[model samples]
Structure formats: structure tokens, C-alpha cells
Target: MGNYQSGDNTIQGERLSRREAVFDKMDDDSFALFYAGRRKYSSGESLFPFAVNKDFYYLTGIEQEGSSLLLSKRGGECREFLFIDPYEESKRRFYGKKLSIDEAKRLTGIPNVLLSTYLTSRLDRLLRQGLDGEEPVKKGYFDYSPELKIGPELDVKTFVNSLKVVYPDLHDLDARPLVMPLRKCKSDSEVEEIKKAAGYAKEGLLSAYSVLRPGAYLYDLGLFYEHAANSASSCSGLCHLTHIASGEEACYRDPFPGQKQAKEGEIVLLDVGAKSGQYGASICRSVPVSGRYTPHQALIYKIVLNCLRAMENLARPLISLKRINEFALDYLACECLREGLLPSKEAIYSIAYPNMVCELGLDCPEDYGELTLEEGDVIALYPGLYLSGEATAIKLKDVYLVTERGCRRLSDADIEIEDIERRFALQSK
Candidate 1:
């Protein structure tokens, strides 16, 4: 089947044929881990239900919590194994229905299935037997451990440590980088999924643009965005937070996840994404709160837009990600100085260090020099300029992608300041 589609639609079943084939081709003794847990939202339960880890779902297609996967490939023979929680009366009453053992086996195409509770015991026996070269199980790799939490928010290092106990004699592999390297380059189908996400994101922007005004609060904008994403498709905003920031707060990067009201003569920034068919897009756009661009805002917007445009022109196969950022950063420095946003080299240097260039996930390489951009590389380029004034301020951001030739702007919306102001005139007045 074709890897990508021109229209916005979910890719399920046979549509994911190629990805399934590739996952099955992974080396034996190797596995990937994914954990979906409840998130605490102040208003109520999170809008999105528990999210399945993208990589884990990519391989086994098992969407459930407390589940693990093992993929074995030896002598050209492939076997997919799934470990999941067995049926429990309390669990059924609490979290709704779970996949029965037989159903999971059929759905995952895995002839072998085991209850999650028996994983440690069964895996231990299997490892010993395989280590002895008796039961056709030889040196295996445990892709994850259920211990030692690390990094931001939901760390799962402990789960990784648990792997050591399960396959004591098997070789340990760094599955994170390995899996990330494979995921770095998007296939045609993956790109199409991202495009579908972008479509819903655009719809969210349209909804926000239609009602946004100077007096609108950031939290209000968030509601508008989520509503549009939800209305577009039942599953459009499956995973991810819809971020809406205004004026100086928009320039502050994370923005502390609070409410910021829109004001005239300020920039309203929306750095948001939507998920369709489990694939996602990271798109951002900025408009003037007053709906019309001010001379000062327009000047800075042009420079930031130019930086993003430059990235689009330079992104291609075989180029390093670090090198790409360097080029973009250098252009930004020059533009910022030329526009008088940053007074000197020192000022420009400080802002670009960790704030300007952000790597979205762990998949990106730490060193830009070692990372090369491949064809069909879906890169998110955020070019922003924040000018914080004592009373009135503005910040503008725009995200784009790199195609075979130049790049495409996924966040399609008008950038004029007045359009934003007038669109919300009824609410503001």
C-alpha cells in the first residue's frame, strides 16, 4: 500500500503495513517500552485519554497500560511477544475493559503471550534456558527496565532496570538511541500523519482567529483551540497540550502554564500541535493583538519570518541538524542586531543559547555535528523575536518544515496585526 495520502484521514490496519514490517525486522532480544498513565489536570480529567507511547505502539500496536513488548528476530525467523495484565475483576470495574489474553494475541499477531505478573518468572526461566542454547532462545536484549526514573516529568528508568532482572544473561542494549535513530527519518505515511495533524491544527487556529481579541485571556484561547481540534475529528487532538500565549509571555518560552490576557499593541503567539492517527505535528504562529501590524512589530516579524524561511531553504538530506541550527542562529543574530532588538553581540549570544533552538524530543541527537538531515526529515523550525518593554511588549513566532526543495509552512494563517484585532472586535468592544 502507499505510505502517504493526499487527504486528511487516519492510517490504521493495513495502512500501517510498512511500519509493521520494519518493526518486525528489528534484531532479536531487543524490545521497546511504553507506559500510559493518568495525568492530573486542574479543571478536570485530561481532555486526552491515556496516551500510548508512540514508539511502543509503532511496534506492537498494543494500546494499554502496564504492558511490555519483546521482538525476536533470529535466523530470519521473526516472533513478536506481548506481555500484558491479565483480566482482573477490580481492574475491569475501575479502568473499563482490558484486552483478554486471546484477543491481545490475535490483535498483536503474537502467537506467544503471557500475563504481566508472570513476566519476571517466565522471562527468567526463558533467559536461562536460552543462555544454555537449549530452547532455541539465545542471547536476548531487554529494551526497557521498569526502574530508575530520570529526565523531565514522567521518567521510566526503573522500568529499564527491571529488564536486567528479566534477562540477566542477555546482552543489554541502549534501545533509546537505537529506536530514536530509526524514528528520526519519517516515512511517507508518517509524513502524511503529520500533515493530517497540521490540518486539524490549522482548523484550531481558524477557530481562535475568528474569536481572538485584545481582551481575550490565554486560557480562553486554549478552550477555543481544543474545541476546534475536537470538532474537526473525533481523534484529532488525541495527545498534546494546546499552548496559547500573548505579548511578552509568548516570548518567555514555557510561559509557566498560566493565564495571560491579550492586550492591544502586543503579539499573540500560538505554539500548538494536534495528533491524528497517533502521529503529531508541532506548529506555531503569531498575530498582533490589535489585528493590524505595527511598524515595530512588522519589522521584527519580518526578521523572525526570514530566519524561518532561511531554515526551509537549507533543510535537505545529508545535512547535520546542529549545522542547520548554527546557520539559522547566525542569521537570526545578524537580523536581531540589524533590527536593533539586541544591541550587541553579547546580547544576541545570551538569548540564542538554550531558548532559541529547542529540540522537541529525545530522538534528536545531542551534538548537531553528528546528526544529518535525511530526505523526508520532518523538522520543526521556530523563529521568534521577543521585545519586552516596561509596559507594552510583543513577541512573534512561526514554525515551518523542510521539504525536498525549500520548505512548507504548516501553520497557515494570516500574520497581519489588524486582522487579529478586528476579528475579535465584537468581543473586545
Candidate 2:
């Protein structure tokens, strides 16, 4: 299977292969249904920019709202169907023409294309036929996640409930278990997209470094980082929130940019990301506003860096996240004891202490809840520190691709303490 390419927009061939793989995994008499997400209202008269459902985009490569995909495996034969919003004059006038049926077919490589308005009738007919046929559909697979709240109009829960009322014998299956594994392991093309995003993130960090001086406001620094990423060719002018913090603010679990001004002899922390081809790269760095780190600050910075390196070394495929966390906790404890920061190993787990390591990902929320340790899953680490009873907080984040052999760092920005000091000194001169 080949990819669909048109101007700046193209879907990789691997996505098509992924869909095929899903089909091959499904039972012979089952069907899967996926929906493109609906646009949400930002305010009274404005709507947030439409973001396609990650799963739907993964399978169909169609990013438009009001779109759906149906894949059926019956009698040892598999077929694909695509449903999309039809051409409407008023909508076209307001938002330009949506993707045409012909273009959708070309983009998605689905042979059957129909207006989304026909979806209800089509599904009803198919389910009825299956009920009357010899090899009826044994299960209906739907994309459902309890964590995500869908609006009334686009609620899959209601649809599934109605389907049960009409066809009580049909079994419903959650598609997440089958699809999440495909998403976790990045393909070559997906890795390239992530690298592009990383490049943009590097540019943003460099831009921030240039203007990182005393009296600089955190908000302006965040804007500078965002502007650099948004201006990059690979970027689609969209990204996650940029976090910029100084001193005590940097030590917080999740810090947001504000009007706080940096002062002399203080370190500034930044956590930013750029999105390209719908993939994102997360990067974090810490810089000294005064162009030099205090001896104490430098020591703490090196500790966090060491922890990051240790985490990188442990990030191999089939390694459990729990193991990684245990390693980090033990490593941090040892370093703390050596540095005289901790009295004993028992104090390592104390929340009041410094040298904490947290997990970071593309979809990780800013206000992440308690970390759960899963034995069968891999982990990503972002290093940061908070010096107890002091006004110092430093954070550094980078994206890593967990490979079969080892982990590969995607965001390879210059984060060395000596390198940062050298750059600042050169700029000062």
C-alpha cells in the first residue's frame, strides 16, 4: 500500500498498513467503527480548532470533522468504508470546501465513500442483515475511552446503548486494547515526524536562550519559544502549552508562564514542545539569567542530569516502567546521600526532599495525578529538582523512543551545564 500525497498534506503508507493489521487481528465476523471528533465551542460565537480523533486519524488519515470509518471482516473478506460530511454551500462559503468524496477516497484508499448523513441507516441495515444471516457479526468494536468525555451529539455511549436495544445479541468490544499497542511503537515514518517536531523544539529553545536575561518576563520568554516553533517549516503552527518558570515557580509540579520577572543569580526553567505531522516533541531546559550558575545551583543541576542519563540507559524495550522507577528512586537516593542532602536511604521517598524524577509524554497532562507503576509497560523520564529550603528549581525534559535494543533521544538539544554556561558567557562577551 502506498501513501496519499497532495500538496503539503500527505498520509504515510504505514498508516494504511496499520489499518490492515487491525483488520487481520479482528474476528472474521466482526466490524470496527471509528468517528472523527466533533468541534467544541470555545465561547458563544467561536469554536476551537477541530482536532481529529487520534485513533480515527491513525486508521483513516482523514482529519476532517464529521467523518467516520467502518471496516468489516466477514466470510474471510475485509472491506473498508468511509463516511464524510457532504458538500454544503453555506459551509463551503464560511470555511472553504471540505474534502470531497473523491479526495477522501484518494487520501484514505477506501473504495466505498458515502455522506455521513447515511451512517445511521447504513449501520441499521448492516446490523439487521447480520442478525438474519448465517454468519452474523459476532461483535461490534467501538472506540471508547472512559477518561474522554464526549458531548451529547457525538456520544458513542448513547450509540452503543441504542445498538444494544436494537440488537441485544451483539457483543460490544473496546477497541483501545487492540489499538494502543500500535500507537506506542512508533514506525519509521512516525519517528521521522517526531524528529521534525524535535527540531522545531530545539529552535525554540535556542531562541529562548538568546533573550534569557535578567528582567525578562516569563510570559515573553514563553512567547519567544512558541514563535520560533510556529515559524518553523515543519510545524503546523500548533503546539502544547509552553512552560516557563523561575526560582520557586520552577520547583512546582506543573508550572505555567506568568508575568513573573527573572532576577540576577536565578535559573529559568522551560518545558516546551512543537508539533509536526500531528506528532509532538517535548523538550525542557534550564538557564541561568545571570550568565553563570552558583556553585550550589551547578551541583544540583548535575545531579538531575545524572539521573536523566541513568534513566536513558534503562529505557529499553520489554523493561517495565516499575523497574525504571525503582532504579531512579535508588539512584537518586544514592546521589542524595553522597551529596549530604539526605541522612539515609529511608528519607529517599520523602516528598519534602529534592531530586525528584517525573514521567513525561506527548499526552501527559500538566496536572498529572499520582504515578502508577505498571510491570509490563515501558517508561519515559524527565529530570527536575527542587532544593529543600532554598529558592532553586531546575527542570529538563527530552523525548526518547524506546527501541528493541535501547532508547533513542529525539530532542537532542544542547543541555550540558558547561555548554549552557559557555553559551551564556559568549553572549555576555
Candidate 3:
């Protein structure tokens, strides 16, 4: 979106500070290695768009592939080195210009920049050199996750494994535990990017709402949102598949936008968003297929909307996701009971609706454990209601920023019944 500047000095300074923090946690004579993921193969001769590793991108803003960051602490001094793909005329002709060492230094604030080919040599030298007659490097930290097993070629696992073979005495550590806590809170710049993404998402949803009507295919409604987002100067496109379901299809768990056609008096459920600067926004809304909601549809929509509102009001610094989830169930239970959707509090879990509030940031629907809210945490509250006997399902999803004074909504679209009816009526006229 717009002219993408790699990052500014302030951003670079922040990244450097983050690296320093990681080094501070390391024991003496310890080091850590992180890598920018490799390009993935989609099919013969074609490749998937390069997605940078979140942990690597968090410490260094460089997004290019085959790059590596090495952070080492010795005695009282910490050293940082960044190794990236070296400039090659052939690559420049085929893939455009690769990032130069000077540019990488400017972007990441790491002065020690070298070619990727030299990474092993550098590590070998470090391992061989010992100060005060002790091992030069005692512990090595890396980001390890089960997902890494799926794509060994794109991760640092192979490289670390090879190191273990040569230096059997070296201790290996998982850096995810060290970096995950740092990632939980968002910086001001990161929050701004997320907010921009949310704003673009709101525009996309509004466009989808205006054109939704009886007989429109669910896929077409999804395209309306994608088109609106793709045309924006700030939006890259829909971050994930737009979820659009109508009638009985709405009750389908994890529905994807399909060819199902809308009908009069049917409720359509949608979950969609756009990406801004690699950050994603998640927003979901429900509306009647016709210009106006039926009485029953309106009742379910209002209940879920109220649940979302209550949860948003309660979000703030120090509020754990466990607390938010408990509040949502309690509020939903009371409302469902009042509406006769549930027979009693004991039957709360029997309702077949998705009622989870998760953190949304660099990744959409991040791991639930990572969604716990603290000051500076950005989260999504998505609550749904499904009446299996009636074959009806409705949901509302929104993102919020946990601030000192509570929380502020990042994804805001008018889901109020009056607003939807008025907008749809205008479109019909």
C-alpha cells in the first residue's frame, strides 16, 4: 500500500532495542540465530509469495529471504550481525534488485552485515575462539515450533541440527519462549499499521453490505468486499478467504465463501478483512439477505451484538483472555435465557455457536494462549449463536486495542439493525 518505506530510524531503533532485550536475557558466552524464511514452491516453476518469519521480522524489519540474524553476548558486550543475500547481477536481472548490505544495515540498525555464504564460516570462527579458557559459545537460542517440522527447508531447524552434529557440547535453547512475551505487546507503530488494516476492512464490509440482496451468490458478496479492499491505496487485499454463508449454510462450522445463493428472509454471515503493511485485521458481521431482517433474525443479531459490546467495554490492561471469555459466556447465557434460546445456565455450552475472543495482530486469529490481553494488546472478540433446530447461525467479530483506560475498537462497522436496514434500503432504491 502506498510507497512502502522499509522502516524509519525510530522503527530501526526500536528493533535494535528489542534485540538488546533478547541479549540481556542470554547467559554469558551465549548466542541466538534467527532466519528469514525461504520462498515456498507452489507448483512447477512457480513459487508462493515470500512470507517472512514473524519472529525474525519482529527483531529485524528486513523481509527478504535467505537472510539471517545472529545475536551474541560475550562477557559484558553484545554483538549483532545480519547476513543477507549478496548482490548478484543475474538475480537483479531476474528478480529485480536484492537488498544491499548498506540498505540492510540502514533498515535493521545492525552494522555487521555480511553475505549469506559467510554465515557458517562466521559461526565456525566464533565456536573455535574461546576467551578466558572457556567455551566461546555455551548456549544457542532458536525459535522452535511443531509447525517448523512441516517446512524444514524454510526454518532454522536443519542448520541448528547440523551445528549440533559438529559441536556436540553446545547447548541449544528455544528462542520462542524468550521472544513470545515480547511479541504479546504491540508497539505504537505496529498498532498504527493494525488500525490502518482495520479501517480498510471496515470500508470493504460496508461495500459488501450495500450490494447484498436476495438471489446474489455468496461468492459474489465476498468479491464485493475484496474488490473494495483491493482498490484501496492502503489495502494489499483480503488477508484471508472471506467467509460468507446464507440460510442453513450459516450453521456450517468454518464456512468458506461459496456459490450458495441468498434468499429472502435468510440471514447471511460474513467474516472478512484486509492486510496493511503485513498486518491483518479480522471483522465479521451478519445481515439479512433481503433489505430488512426478519423478526427472528433481528433477535439473534441483537443478542450477539450486545455480547460483543459488553466484551469490548470490559477489555483493558491486565484483563486476561480467560476473564474476557468467562464474561462473554455469562453475558451470552443471560441474554440467551432472556430470549429463550437457552433453557438454563446449565445448557450454556450446548449452544452450537463459536464464542471465542482472540488476539489479532501480525497474524489473524493468533493462538488462544497468546491472545491474553495486557496493555497494548490488540484482540478480536467474535461471538456467535447457532440454533440447530431452526437452522440459523449469526456472529459478530471486532478487534480492540487494550489501553490504560479500557479498550478502543480498531475494527468498527455499523452492525446495528437500523444501520443495516437503512443502508440496504438506500441501495435498493
Better of 2 and 3 by TM-score: 3
- lDDT tens per residue, model 3, 207-260: 887678788888888888888877773447556778889777777777887877
TM-score list, all predictions: 0.77, 0.88, 0.91
Kindly list the per-residue Cα lDDT of model 1 for residues 1-429, writing each as its tens digit.
Answer: 122232233334432442345455456544333333333333554433455554566655666766776554445554445678788778887777888988876565556677877655545545565422545343544344333122223345454455556655455554544445556555567666666776787778778776667677777777778789778757546345666677556656555325667787777777776776676666667776776777777777677777766777776766666777778678878887876667875576555533333322212212223666665556666656555552222333333444666556555555544555455555455
By summed lDDT, the worst window of 10 consecutive residues in model 3 runs over 1-10
- Winner on lDDT between 2 and 3 is 3
- In candidate 1 the C-alpha lDDT for residue 206 amounts to 75
* Ranking of candidates on lDDT, top first: 3, 2, 1
lDDT to native, each model: 0.58, 0.73, 0.78
Candidate 3 Cα misplacement greater than 4 A, ranges:
1-9, 130-134, 148-155, 233-237, 352-355, 368-372
Per-residue CA lDDT of candidate 2, range 1-429, in tens? 223333323453566677888887788788888888677777787877777777788887787888888888777777777899887777888877898888888777776889998887767656777523544565888888543224525478777887899888778998765566566556666667777887898888888888889998888888888889888834465457788888887777658889899999988888887877776777788889998889988887898789889888877755555566677777777887899877896786552333233333234321123433322222346766566357787666777766666777776788898888898888877
Distance (Å) between predicted and true CA of 267, model 3?
1.4
Question: Where does model 2 exceed 4 Å of error?
Answer: 1-12, 131-138, 146-152, 233-239, 349-379
